[model samples]
Target: MKLEDASSGSLGPVIEVIQSILNQTGYILPALVLFIIALAIKYPNRLPGTTDPKHRPGVYFPPGADPLIGHTRMIVGFGSEGQFENFKALSDATPAGSWNVSFLGTSSMTFVNRPEYLEYIQKTNFDNFPKGSQFTGRLGDLLGVTGIFVADGHPWKTQRKQASHMFSNREFNTWVRAVIHNELDDISALLDNVTAKNGPGKLILPELMFRYTLSSFAKMAFAANLNCLSPDPDSLKRPVPFAVAFDRAQAIINDRFITPGWYIWEKFNKTGRDMRSSIKTIREFGLDIIHKRLAERQDEKKDPLAPVEGTKKEQLKKEGKDLLDFFMDLTTDPEELLIVVLNFIIAGRDTTAQSLSWLFYELMAHPEHVPKIRKEIAEKFGEPEGGVRLDYESFRELPYTVACLHEAIRLHPAVPKNGKAVMKDDVIIPQGPNPDNLPPVRVFAGERVGWSDWVMARTPAIWGADCEEYNPSRFLETDEAGKLHLRNFGQWKSHYFNAGPRLCLGMNLATYEATAFIAAVLPRFNFEWATAAQGQKSAWPPQYANSVTHPIKDPYLVNVTRVKA
Candidate 1:
């Protein structure tokens, strides 16, 4: 009875307290309830940066954008290489060259597609544009601080001159070319394996292509060979850590657009940990080499710097021979040197491999095109010596093949989106064609512009109604006298090798590697669909933004067959 009475007393006090509170706040209660109700009424459920662009006051979404995530959903469903069609549709939905895209953390950013506009930003206003901090800062692992990819100001100039002088000069080309060509070993081995084992039936997708390129980069860039492809070899060598670090870094940069907090949040994620560790290894590796060389400085056997005696003597006596050798010729900023060279290897390795894979796919799908390309090769160089190579001039002259490769790059470039910052408050690009029938654009400081490569490559305004088609014929132009000039191959005389002072330094090398690899493989081997056992799940049914324009994600398990002689 005492317990029951105590419980009753507690209930009574609680009821009394509530009544007293309600009585004291009689006027405020209704207002509070009304405020809560009004908020729910005014704004329904809203995700960050996910809203109707037309109705939003500050950010603008393009016309017909889905209120939630805008074009994000549509783009996500399309694979990197496969996204061209959707990009075309979205492109056509707006102005030819200029439109606002919902990006950079759920906000709408401008998308520029016209050739003239690209040419201007590339050439005239090159000084004002640079890769943004957001893109570079994510590389906290692979690059210690600054790299040729991220640095601006006079620093970039110093690095550029050093890099270009070493890489572009004749001396570096001689040794570097031979080193890169040696990677063809893997390419040949892969083709021979495919041809001998598979016959005309099974398809083997090219995942080895990734490992091959990575190993090749080791040889060309560092004068070391990290063979990821040897039988019974552990593919995850030091290069894996380095490559992982770079991939995760770029991936985190890409994620900023979706979650916005990915870079920070990923601190606790698996890739983030891997990336951090990889950076430590890279630094240690670099330091070890530096110290070893210093130790060897006093030795008489073989000193790379033996020719240079004093501090200024060595400074005055550098030449380009390898990628690192080129970096050695440049500035003495050790941090920048390590960072930029690592970034360069990342760029050179994977992108070229991707292009080659796509080229193979295109060749197989368009089998007839293969014979034509082979005919061109036979005519130009003739009879296949196992080591028969096409020099730079010969590689450039294969118009149809070059056009086909251009089409592939156009539709499926490695870097799908370009991120650049508008330097200074006064920089603005006005819209309209530059007497060449192109669109107009304007840019401002702090504003980041990401022009979609797919949009520019396949936009109808740029490439006509059949812009999305993978037809090499589109790239061909026959003169009145029936002679084909190089102009017939690219819609823009430059097909996304990019334009301006910031053009890719590795363009010539990349093209040579890609063309040679393809020329060597296509005529000799045949690839079909991969086996069920070989197929792995693809994250690419809907590709993330981190990839090159595309990836062969469905675990391509194609058996290979040697072509009849």
Candidate 2:
């Protein structure tokens, strides 16, 4: 089925769920009444010097910020690319490579683009910068309050420790590789069928990638074959409803971050109502999955044929344990299980899927790299017909292919923007001596600080003058053997997977899956821009949706053909 059909199967129950959420706003009414009173006091700036905006020292307050509305107009009005341009302009305006803007005169937000400031908040003083209440509050309803993504302090540590097992274990790595290989085989078959039936299909790449990654992750995480990549359209409907609702909920929640006093306006807006309904559907589906897994575990325990106690890990190695099995060992509470599982899905699926979609875009833009990538794959795994799959160790040897993937993300990071809240007053210091005359910027408690990897990715100082160019060679270096090797551009320079204590838990798994996918498909299929009708430009320099992740605004239409080899 097409991506649009994900929510098509059944909506009668969803509408009922929406009405149920709308009807149960008992406390929301009182909050709305208080908000009205607050608005009366807040809207008309009564303080002295309120007619003109007041600027703070060491802060670049760009034009168009009204004293009454602040930057709310741009935040709400601008598209994703426009917003990126605004931040890029701000980064260029200051030597410190960061800027601040007020919101509704009540709160201020700082946008950090420099590597020094990024390290300061994400790594150096990580404890002081947690995903505080403001950030978590925006996401609490969708991603549960206690999930690893929303949690801070001890709760986050506990979940992180438990989840770390999957990445650290060698056996689990091998198991994950086999699962990815299996998924890629299925994708190849589906594409092969399409090519046989028709000459070349105009594929929406992001949709296809998302489905492939979702199905792959579902198997590794829950041992459930969602078959979201099924050729049979009817079989695809079962999981599409939950997938659609999940995607909608994430996009809406991300908007809450920039919308000033969002909680106040959300109650009365259509966006807010849609968010509530989406959350209801998401939670219902998640709870059902959790409960069914729990029941299966109970049945496993009673089976006399189950693995003996001491050999359980070995048995899991052979049978391939899902992430849910690990979490079940940690907690029996259904709510907690649901939160972690959903968080796992977001981490394991969305980021990598988006990254690969953009990778293909990069490949299309620079088709010369296609032969290079395919040659490297052939050297390592023979040819597509040979059916040789890269395991955990062998996948690491394809340095050039991995470099292309790295460079693609360097330009278009999946999680392009991330931030942390200040716990107390602090001064942000640049890493090097004050060469640019960049002064230290003081930040107070209760303020938010964010960094845009998108801007940093294109910064002239960080990546030289040709930073905008798509060149995979930048991520490689010649070693003693005279062969190209992947450069280790540490966390600060390569901050896509994040850094410090809150680093991405699924980084290794994501890398393995993406590289393996490139290996699998490049040898068998070719991609290029889909032909456009007269007067159209084929959506060059792709536009992105203003969502939680960097999703292509429209369908990423591409021409897919089979290789003659």
Candidate 3:
């Protein structure tokens, strides 16, 4: 008899026997459970056909992957502190440059560590490997389907085209410059006030950087002035509602990535409720700004030459327009407007703040490099005594400052890993040593392919033996005469800003802002890591919290004193 027919025929008798045994002694049930637990513990990845050494015809999966669950348990076991450790393990396991594994026993994931494969996925076959629905669906609740980050296909292309136009505008660059200068001035004043009140003030740099970037983006992109740097009692008491909501929404959205299925969270869970609430708060904030901007734009259209009677246009030229105004000209859909605005804010704010925080941490750790950066800035922009106003042209001259920012980001990239889902059956040719002379790995449709900037940036094969060290000088090359010169390693090799069609539109703006801020701050303040006592050793490599962007885990406390030049 066939197994199915035999099982069906014996079901009633088997149930009767089990029930009779259970009725007789409940202790047997516990013993059976213990036996199963022992078996699982002894052979975690021993599921049938998973550990076979034989290579499959299409793709090669590493030997240790569990047949169903994949590496989920191992990843979760590491927690936040050991997250990078787990990624390192995966990277080491994929000696042939790529490997396939099942996630949650439902979806197939192919991780690619080679730059050649990254080029293939992001550029050569970009259309074939779009950010598929699964990736978008995970972030849809928070980001919606309208923005470039989560958008795919025609919608993504349209958004990218529109954003590219706006970013390239000369007027937009001027507006960005004005916003950065103003925010940096505010930060300077705040620091001065702290120093005046208490000699050598201690500061949590990450928090301050976040506020600075948030306020800067708010003023430049949206016409809202969120006084995030204000020191007044009233301002301190009343926090920016939208800022809080946006942060909470991001946290909740990131949680979804590690969570299992949609039904588990969406059907009956507090996480779903919290997500909806956070999105509502964020949407409401974006809509309010959109409507306000729309009205202002309508007024301008009625009388183009008549300057708006306020400080709103202070940062913009008579003919200049903010991003929202640009979007208003394109589409009047509020949802679309909100998505675009939020997307820009997130891209601008989080990445810049995190990058700055990491830069400062590196500066504190390696104080010897500080004077070199300061000397370069002072030579170009004069001393930051009265305060330095960095414009588009002047900002480019401080190449050392820019190199420091790049080095920091290389070490601690904001968006460490980026994923793209395969829309068709695509084959990736291995670029590394194929000991088995393995053929091209055939990736199936619906499988997710990704590249980890965190892993790739630190790989010895790509960046050499000293890749783990924080040396900005690596970005600089010595000529035959032994004079050092800066090298522009473009986004393709860097991978921090990503590459191909989806390259970060705000790359220029982010680089300029970071460079300018460093120029402005370094000349005015004597920075050092805060110590428990004057004679004690300061904390060197700060503990960091792992996320899409790796931020310093705790407040990066630093002692700041006004420099006497």
In the range 158-266, model 3's lDDT, one tens digit per residue, is 8898899998988777777777777777777777766775577767667788888888888777766766677432243356777887777677666566666754766
Best by lDDT: 2
The TM-score values for the models, in the order shown, are: 0.76, 0.85, 0.85
Tens digits of lDDT, candidate 2, 79-134: 44577777788878876677776565236678878777777787777888899887
Best-fitting candidate, scored by TM-score? 3
What's the true lDDT of residue 367 in model 3? Answer: 83
- Cα lDDT of all candidates, in order? 0.58, 0.74, 0.72
Which tens-of-lDDT digit does each residue in 462-508 have in candidate 1?
Answer: 67788777787776787899866445433233546666677777777
Angstrom error of the Cα, residue 487, model 1: value is: 2.5
In angstroms, how far off is 193's CA in candidate 1? Answer: 4.0
- Give the runs in model 3 whose Cα sits over 4 Å from its true position: 1-64, 231-238, 305-319, 430-439, 478-484, 532-540
Model 3 compared with the native: what TM-score?
Answer: 0.85
Q: In model 3, what lDDT does residue 193 have?
A: 68
Q: Model 1 — which ten-residue stretch has the worst lDDT?
A: 308-317
